[model samples]
Target chain A: MRKKPALWGLHASPPGLLKYVLAALPFLVVVLVYLIASDLRHDVNHADKLLPGFGQMLDSLKDLALVPDQRTGKILLLADTLASLKRLLIGVVLASVFGLFLGVNMGLLPGFRALQLSFVTFFSMIPPLAILPILFISFGVGELAKIVLIFIGVFPVIARDIYLASTQVPREQVVKALTLGATQLGVIYRVVLPQILPRLLDTVRLALGPAWLFLIASEAIAATNGLGYRIFLVRRYLAMDIILPYVLWITFIGFSMDWLLRRYMRWRYPWYERGGN
Target chain B: MTDTLASKYQLVIQDVHKSYGEKKVLEDIDLTVRSGEFCTVVGPSGCGKSTLLRLILGQEDVSSGFIYIDGKPVGLPSTDRGIVYQRYSLFPHLSVLDNVILGQTLRIAPWSARSKRKAFVDEAMVYLERMRLAEHSHKLPSELSGGMQQRVAIAQALIAKPKILMMDEPFGALDPETREEMQIFILELWDASRFTVFFVTHDLEEALFLGSRIFVLSQFYTDQRGNGQQIRRGAKIVADHHLPKTPLSAETKRAPHFLDLMESIRRDGFNPAHLQHVDDFNLRHPDSFRTLSPGEGDSQSDRMPQLWDKSQ
Candidate 1:
């Protein structure tokens, strides 16, 4: 049967140029709502830190970013960004390596799967925030504690997701590799590893949200510098101006990281996408 | 070596039986194939033809007897055997050439080592040329047609130079024209290389066209195992016929003797009531034999064992 694209319906193919504006519609509406709320709140009180106006927000960001903090002798925004980024990078790198190793082994070997699957499943259930006091008391409110918290929070989920992806690799492919002269280890690293790399990146992207959550929680409870620490420190004065910009900056960084990772997956593995994974 | 019977056979399955708990999937499978023989097996769906292929491939255990390849007992699947499924056997992350060269690379130096990689690439290129896939070598398997992909799979398997190439419906996913073209393509490659093959397909006609010897596996046959009751058994070789290895031509399909043999095989294996006695089964190949030992529960009606010679 011959079928053509329809103008509008479930099978409709919209004009390409209209797609861009349509995607931006909801985002534009959210900004407008916040702007109106900020203006109305400012009108009621001449000085309102709860929902600062656009000008006040901009000035607060400039002060935090360009000028040095009087107490800390550091550009608060730059220093916070660096400190937060360092922890995030180390934590995520460690989690990815550990998760990939654990998950792949669990998938390929029956004994390893039986040994570790339950333990990993149970480990992922422990809430990072619930153990915050224990971590603080043990690691003593240092960078180690914050980094470890993020690691514990993100690693298990990454491992579990990677395990699932590894298992989902078609059994036929493994058999085919064996038939083609691959040993057991050869199948894992040579045949299976390349197939799972993209899925690992996708899992990391999904795990980023919780990584940030754990980072912020740890910093809020105990830290000298970080975006999360700065946000909490300003909360005593209700400096919404500083808090809002910091929150926005954090979101922008997370979004960019996710996007870059996704693009990397696509670029490195063109055939994987074609495999319709 | 010449004194032993098993040495004459390229693959020997002796008293091979398989079952899952109470359900029997294959039983009394004793078939031996000679070296360089293109043996095609056709059977009705669910007759466990694929299971038999897996047993020979060492992907699954037979549950009873031993399978010897090149006079060596087979175990878990290894580089000694090569297989091509209907699809998805090729690594998607690798290019067509990479897929074909995987055997050589994994057998050679570490993946990072490239000192003699050029030799492996050159060997792969020759197989690619034979399969008419040389130009598409650098492209991904996803970029090729179904027939092209199967060709690449064949080249991939053939490059390794395994003892036997086992293909399970290798061209089943292709269109009619592509399927015929691939059948002929494989025949040409086999005629040149003389690699032993164990091809499984449900299409009876394709079996006649491609095989130097055709094996019909079916569950429709009856035997003397039951005491006036039906014995629940699985597929076995109901018939085996030797075909001449003529170079590819469409006219052989239209020949009267070929048509008659095809029809008889269809009747012998496809019809439930036409089951011949176990001894009288039409195993016409010179290499064919029934190594029935001990209480297989035989009766007086079983055919007498003989050294089969068409002249006799």
Candidate 2:
């Protein structure tokens, strides 16, 4: 009897090169379809607004990135990116700090949990986009409003996720820490907090999508400069070239942030991914 | 009299009863452990062995009773009672060295911990070497094998110099070979340190091998409460034997006397069908005692003649 080959069943795993090819296959197909669609649209109309050709997009990218704005004398893409990233960075950092504090305390302490759990649950349930007008009205249409919008949009979810993660930490660990002479606060801050930080980063990575959504929405509503503002600004003239690249740029930034967070989690907390405790 | 007795014993658990809402877990548990004694508890699964350990550790409050450690009632789990659980004994976030030194670091302020880091590391390294885990000090707990992790946990607990070290099936997760190895290692550690140890396991052989005094806790005994559906009797110490602290050897497990004792304990504690009368429990240990509540053992007098006749 001959031994069976291993490649096409439950026991089969794809080889390394095949695995890479499998991963890239769908992405390549999507790009191919988009190119074909762009060509067909351009053939019908020389200046197609819906699906701009690659050359048209490339020219717009150069203009937005390299050329200075006529009125402000600043490069629009760079300025917008900086503004958007500043808001995003401030909002996410604040959310992470406050979320970690609230979430860990709520999970570790009964009094904190009883006080904040229901309130956070209710707060997280409110659709952030629905409260956009309220945020603008309360904080005004400045940078504060945009940052607040993103903060409100992301923090509660992060807090709740971190709360769940914190609670998932074994009760045995808490008892062990206490037995080790850790004070109540020491157990929370030193023992429980370090263990949950990787989970917090994971929560932040998940919350980044909603953070970007809120950033774009708020910037579209009212902003002089931002990635979202530029996209909306170009949309008025039906400049699909600028809009598409700006959207792609936002995606790239979000993807990179998520990737960086995952990498940092693995690097800093080597035990976390390995399911240490 | 009680004051002197309490002072004499390293740990005194008296008339301890634990219940959760409608379910009773432990009843009338009275155990007095001396300093440097290895008291091992064995029982059937869900026989409330771990519950009794937790109550002594002050991780949970007994429904009614007092657990005094060093003549004082235990309030919350503290450095006085260091525990090594079967799993999750060491913090995964910390390296082996950090885990061992955690007890000292936690007792001190952050700045002091930094300034005294070298002294702490040196002390922890001593324990690491003792546990034969010196080379793995820098590695995280996850990187080590099961037995090694447990060794690290033991080192972590020992560094605290707890009044009574509690281990709840610390070797339960290891393979048989590793478990045997750990048993020998712990016995040596206990012999050298002479710390009061309260070890709980479901393994009868382990209890017999490691304990100076072995307690068989079970819900498998008869009482005035009877076998009615409503009679919710919790586990009690049905048998407590004072075993001689023989020289540590795996070969001793094959001894005829050891096998006989193990067999009798299995029948007494693990056999639900062979429920010994409460009045006739084989509590042979000098420190072993039980408090009988009203009507707990009252009817056992009338049942004794019937039991004797049935056996004859």
Candidate 3:
């Protein structure tokens, strides 16, 4: 008879150098395949076709270093991209902190979620573009409007996700904790918070994509420097070379951000076995 | 009839009644558990066995009765009464060790004799080791099986060293093999710990095995005219809830003794009128109590101290 696997040691395989070698094989294969295929693809050049082969694509990735002269525009674009990244990063941090507080409060408290959900949905429904005019009118077309826009874009999704996560924590656990001499706050921190955190980690990562999308849009309109503004500038002069490269750069950054998120999720929450849920 | 207090007596529950919105669940339940007695309550589903447990723990309100633990009214849940639930009520986020130690942390009396948090933790580890869950201290509840999770739940409840432990079908969800193993494990643990336990189960055989005394709760019967009735048609305290006489702990379902008791109970279960007839028949022919069959006679009484002193 086959014995059931010991539940405690489900993930406790002994570490070995060979294990890492074995695990890396699939990823290494994928990388090699991508590199070979990218090299094989060639493109004919036109004067208007500023974006050339994958070599130019690789060069543009390297060209993040800010240079003077004709490259100054590109360098300024890189700086703007970095600034946008910084703002998005800050917005995520702030929203997560604030959202957790509100989400938990709303989750635990009976009437609070109903009241907050209506208001959050109302605000979230107002498209980021629609709010831009009001934000510009109020805070001017500067960093302040951009920050508020990012906050608006990111906070609702987080608060809602947290609300769902915190509320979704099993009722039995909460009741058991309370009955076992845990104070209300003790129940939240000790029992409720731990269960909610992993899903919320996924939530925040998911929210980052939209946050970047809205931030880029905000920068495209009013900002003089940033990657979005630079992209718009290159578009006006039909500088497809610069425009296309920055687009590729944005895609790569987004892809890397998402990949890192996936890796972190896998490392921290291996028990989330149900894929594509 | 408050005679001599048993040597290791811990709690005395006297007439605890619980009702919700005029729906009385437990009506006048009275029992006193000695320090090490494994008293189990068994009945059909929704027979207020759970309500009796909640009343003892003081987690729910008693509509018209009271419970005393060590001769004091139980106002609310306390660490002195540890409860192990059937469901996996473990905090999923914390590791097994942390879950076990949660009860001992924060809000313990500052002036108490037992100081130092690490000592309490070490003591908790000993209980975990008893359940064979010591090595999984760092693993989260999600990484455990149903049986392992229940063991951790038991370890956590026992960690506080409560005087009276209450368990609600702790082995209800496990498979038959695991269930029997858990039953034996709990029995041994109770023997070692010497804490009085109040266990609730729907299985009568389980009740007979584990309980030093068994309290049968009346079924939920609703009367007409919009009132709820607890049909206590043939309800009374079966004082000696211990195993039957004859050194025959191996209970066969086909045995005359077991079959008579099961048949008698089954007849009462389906027909309330038939239950009253059985009682009347017993009363009319007290000397010839052979209706229950000769084999079932004195089976329960045999486990008692002696036949002469049994009534007293």
Candidate 4:
């Protein structure tokens, strides 16, 4: 029950810190493999075979050997991973903004709740990938369509959960607000929405998973960029090293977003942790 | 003629009648709650005590009659009146301060309002301090205990500086000790503000402890035509006579007259009218009249309409 400390410009507890370190384990292993391969390839500098660097690196690691292969390729893979991470981080930031706006509005307003729940539920029920073709057809091979798909996939679920949580707030409280002479907007913003924001964050944490999945799916189909497309491109040549870095990058981004969101939830809504009775 | 100098009265209900379809709940009910008086309306469950309160607060409409606040007929809820329900009707999302300030935000002056956030916050803090809910200012409604939450609800209502306060069984759910404490706290609060209170309760002791004048609603009866109607709805003063005009002693708790007044309301006005059938009257001996509570007298007088001859 100890509180998590705010550290390193990230709101994370010891466990969250541990989780980040653990997530980096796979990349560390990749780096170790690259280092060993370079050490072996360096020993065979005059070799005429393409596989010498990899094969020698594999054999040298078995024999405790040192060699240098082309180091530039590994650096390129790291750069690609960083670029994908940046894109996803940007994507998540945009999604969070859109989700919070849509969710808070739908959750806090009765008329909006009634108007939106049906359509939002309808869209959410359809497997996000099922609509990929429609997205590809309409906004083919564009990042706009992928971002829009992510926005649609994330916003509705978050909005619906937040709307229900806010609306389901006890009738007595709403009456209490009204009786106190609160204007309609005051009741919603001051009285109603604050109570719902925590629950909305919870929904966002859940929706982000599907949001990432959809973003990856859409990128794999249409986008010429992003980890999803990059990973798919590497698969044709069985370039596991290239694909592995992208996989590690995507996982890192997802985990970081989840952690960041949860951390923010804990800070902004401490009552949420106590279950608020 | 008995007009209060500062405020004539908190509420004046003139010939109020409430009907749901063919069923009549309150008929020709006239009541005037004077400022600074704590008025309790006691009745059996479902006798429209809550409906009466709702009508006074302008939450529900009266089929016929005028509900006036300080001589002004009110058609909608206004900040001048505050209400507490038996159940804790607190907004669970907002902190105690936010809930208290929710209503006042609308009335705050625009110039100082935007800039002087501290003033508004300080005002809310003052009310929270008064309610002893200062520590819970940042806690959500559900995080507090039931009693604390109820206090917050009361605070939320009072923060608007309402002229009249209405309560429907506000302490009906508390244990005896908590209930007594709440009653005393409310009385103290009322003494400070001296706002008129329209309190409803089924507990007779609660009625006597809090109410300056207790009005008991008789049980409703259905006519042969299957119409559910209030019994003697016009007769709010059936036992207003039992209420003593002189100041009561601090030891009024042990006084016989106080007990007698309560017994009368219960035996005659409440139990017989609400529970016992009219045909069962012959089971009692003639000498039972001496032992009967004052409430029984009203019923007895009503039953023997022929024997109870009147000039009218």
lDDT for each residue of candidate 3 in A99-155, tens digit (9 for 90 to 100):
787787788877887778789877768787787889999999888888888888888
Where does candidate 4 stray beyond 4 Å?
Answer: A1-117, A240-249, A273-277, B1-9, B14-29, B58-66, B73-76, B86-99, B106-114, B121-129, B132-145, B218-254, B268-312
Q: After superposing candidate 2, which stretches have Cα over 4 Å from the reference?
A: A1-12, A274-276, B298-312
How would you encode candidate 1's per-residue C-alpha lDDT over B1-312 as one tens digit per residue?
222647788888877888888888887788888889999999888888999999998888888877888788898888888999997778888999999888888875474548767888999999899888899999999899989999999989888888899999999889988988898888888888799999999999899999999999988776666423347776788898999866588678888888998899888888876766666788777878775533233553245444432222
Q: What's the TM-score of candidate 3 when only chain A is evaluated?
A: 0.74
User: How do the residues A1-30 of candidate 2 rate in per-residue lDDT, one tens digit apiece?
Assistant: 655444676666777888899899999998
Question: Clash totals for all models, in order?
Answer: 1, 0, 4, 11
- Deviation from native of the Cα of residue B4 in model 4, angstroms: 15
Candidate number of the best lDDT = 2
Q: Model 2 chain B, poorest ten-residue lDDT window?
A: B303-312
What 10-residue stretch in candidate 4 chain B is worst by lDDT?
B285-294
CAPRI band for model 1 = medium
Best by TM-score: 2
Tell me how far the alpha carbon of residue A12 in candidate 2 is from the true structure, in angstroms, after superposition. Answer: 4.6
TM-score, chain B, each candidate? 0.91, 0.94, 0.72, 0.76
Cα RMSD of predicted structure 4: 10.1
Candidate 3 CAPRI grade:
incorrect
Q: Which candidate ranks first by DockQ, i.e. highest?
A: 2
Which of 3 and 4 is the better model by DockQ? Answer: 4
Backbone clash pairs for candidate 2 read: none
lDDT for A53 (candidate 2) = 84
